[model samples]
Structure formats: structure tokens, C-alpha cells
Target: MAVLTASFFALLLAAAPAKAPNLAGTWRGGGFEIVLKADGSGTIKDSEYSPAEPLKWKASANALTITEEDEPVAYSFKQDGDRLHLSGGDLDEPVDLVRGAASAKASSKVDPQAAPGSAAKHVGPGSCDGACRHYLKCAGQPALQAQCVLACYSEGYGADFMGWFQSLDCVAAITVIAMLEAQSRGLQGGGGGGASQSKECEGCRWDGSSCAWYSQGNWGSNVAYSGAVITCNSSCCGR
Candidate 1:
């Protein structure tokens, strides 16, 4: 698989402004019993992680730990003073485990400090601009493209591509490849992004669920490959 390196949202528990130990109790919601105490000890009660085996957990920090056993059994959580927030492992990628048995993570963050009517806020490195972006800009050059093709082929795009693209002459075919890459845009917005299902159509931003195919323009089902059965495009990918 092509490894796309880019900035992505990492799940982490917000460090409470004040840390005491009142996190003890049978707090259950996203399918686990969350417990907290003065000693900073905690455990999420998972019943169906695995048969005959006790539930397991990994402490990511002094306040966070992931508990699970099966396919959809990955998760992390945190507490902002009085509010408790939790997210699962499959939040970014698509998890195709058992439906009823399929547990997934969350796409957004949970800030209990927000007012009841307040909106959500996300964190982490927002974009890649300096070095990484500079490298990708001139990657279309012939000499460079030539070297890349040879290297990529040896690494694989070679044996797999039996067409003229694999020919040495393709070193000068940078424009064609660049244009084709632009058309596909398959790997554009890296890391669990692109044409994933949006709540609305890009044209109308309708937040609709009915996504069509992927056409290019400014929008439409560009995220169809991410298992977006119905993309939320203006005309469902018909740009």
C-alpha cells in the first residue's frame, strides 16, 4: 500500500487544569465501564472483548488508557475535570468488523468545558508547508521523475507497470503523468480524508447523505474510495 505521510489528528486526553482523583464510579456509555480514583487508577470494563479472557488495557498516559480485545476493541479516553470524553480506535480509518459487534471511534473531540451551546474544537499540527511541501513541488521533473520511476519500479511501480509508462522514454513524460495524477486525486487529502462521506454536498453543502460518483471540479464524491457508498456531492459525484 502507498504510505501517505501527512499531518493527522492524534487522539489524546485533554490534561485537566486541575488533577485530583474523583474518577471512580461505574461510568458507562460508549460500551465500557470507566472508573477513576484518587490514586489515578482506572479501568474500562469490557465484557465482549474476548470469551474466557479478561479485558486488557494499555495506559497511554497517567490519565489515558486503551481497553479492548477484539477487532473493534480499540479505544482511548480522558477527563476534563467533571466531563468525561472517550473515543475508539477506528475513528480515522474504516473498520469492517461485525456490525453489532463493530465498535468504532469518534471523528471529533470532546471538550466538556464548552458551554452547552458551544461548538467543537480540534487540535494538532494543521498542515505541512515547509520541507515536505517543497519536495513534492518539483517531483515532476524529468531527471527526477526518471530517477523516481526507476526507483519506484525497482521498489515496485516497475514490475507492475507493463505499459509505455515503464519505458525509459517516460522520463520526459512528466506532464502526462502529472495530468493523470491530477485527474485521479485519489491520495490528495492524506490520512483518512478526501471524499469520505460529508454531511452536506460541496455545491450546496447540504449535509446530505446521498453521494454520487466522483467527478472533478471543486467538489463531489472525491471520497468514494473510502467506502463512501453515498458521497455528499451536489449531484453525488456528478460535478
Candidate 2:
């Protein structure tokens, strides 16, 4: 009867449901963040500066579903150690998130940029001036300006929303800078012209030749750029 009992227990174990993966923690990537609680409640934010939105999530071994705005969205997910990769269901592209450290705490009252060890800090008074000057210096070179913006953002150069906006003015200053540079060089290329408007480039005007910036309604907003055309309400530069 011992053999019989052992086989019966094995069968029962086989019939039991598999335990869900442990996803209760904060995950962040590319300025987007999600905090999943053990109690199935959560919050998601598109950026470090944006407000969080409430959410409810349930997970199986290989799938995760999030309910927000009274609607349910599903995704196929895979976790490799502390890295989470999610795809499908309202996602145009896959999003990868890294698990926060053990001491990381996220809350409605917290400013994400102010988190411990966060790389978001100011450069004293008039922090925007440095970035604007950098843009002016690199006006003729798109590659240099792009690299400058990327480096500035990564180095935590801006103090607040206005400071961040001022840094973007670096891109705007390209017009005047390019114009003066061309005149000095006796080059035929001129600055300032109407670029083709699109949904992506809203709140920004791009000169046909080079340079683009937030002309209106781009405050405290993320932007996306495709070549010269800028996409509003999305990431500025993926680099």
C-alpha cells in the first residue's frame, strides 16, 4: 500500500495549480514606471514627472493583465532575474523594466526624480543657461546638438519643469545660431522655414533644413522625434 499511496500523492501534486511568478515590486525603464503591490493593486506612470495612474494586476506564470480606466489590458511577460520584458496588448513595442533595489520605495507623494541615488538634480541657479549655450555653440552640427541634449539630460542638468523647457529651447536657438553661422561662412543654406506639420510634431516647429523646438503647448510634456519631425506627448530622444 505504500507504493499505491506514493503514486496517489504524485497525481494530486500534478493536478495542483502552478504558483504565480513574484511580480510584487517597482519596475522602471525609459522614464516609465510601474509599482505592483502584493495585494494586486498597483500604479503606473508614463514618466518620472507625470502623475501616477491607479491599476489592478493579476499574473500567471507567463502572462500578466492590468486593469485601468475600467478596462483590462493583457501582455505576455517573461522575467529573467530582475529584468521583466512585456509585449502585446496596446503596446506598440515591447517595454523592458528593471526591478528596483530592495530599498526603493514608490508613492503618490514622492517625486520620482528625487529618489535615492536618482540622477536628477540641478546645476545651481539658471541651470537652463548652460544647455542653451551649448545649443548655441553646436547650432550648425545636428550630431553635436543631439549628443549634447542626450548628455545634458542624462547628467541631470535641469532643475524643474521650466528648466527642462529652457533646455529644449536649446533646440529652438538653432534657428538663429544656424542663420548667423551660415552668414559668417557665406553658405547658401538658410535657417527658418515651415516644416510639414504632423500629429507627431505638434507643439514644435521644425525648420526645413535643421533644428526643432517646442513652440507652444509643450510644457511638462514628453516629445518624440522622427528625423526632423517631432512627436508630441512621447519620448524626446530614445538615445
Structural similarity to truth (TM-score) of each candidate: 0.21, 0.46
How far out, in Å, is residue 128 in model 1?
A: 36
Q: What are the per-model numbers of colliding residue pairs? A: 12, 4
- Residue 32, candidate 2: how far off, in angstroms? 1.6
Task: Residues 173-204, candidate 1: write the lDDT tens digits.
Answer: 23334433433353344443546323223332
Each model's lDDT: 0.31, 0.53
Compared to the true structure, candidate 1 yields what TM-score? 0.21
Query: Mind giving the per-residue lDDT tens digits that candidate 2 earns over 111-143?
Result: 433332122222224343444433433343323
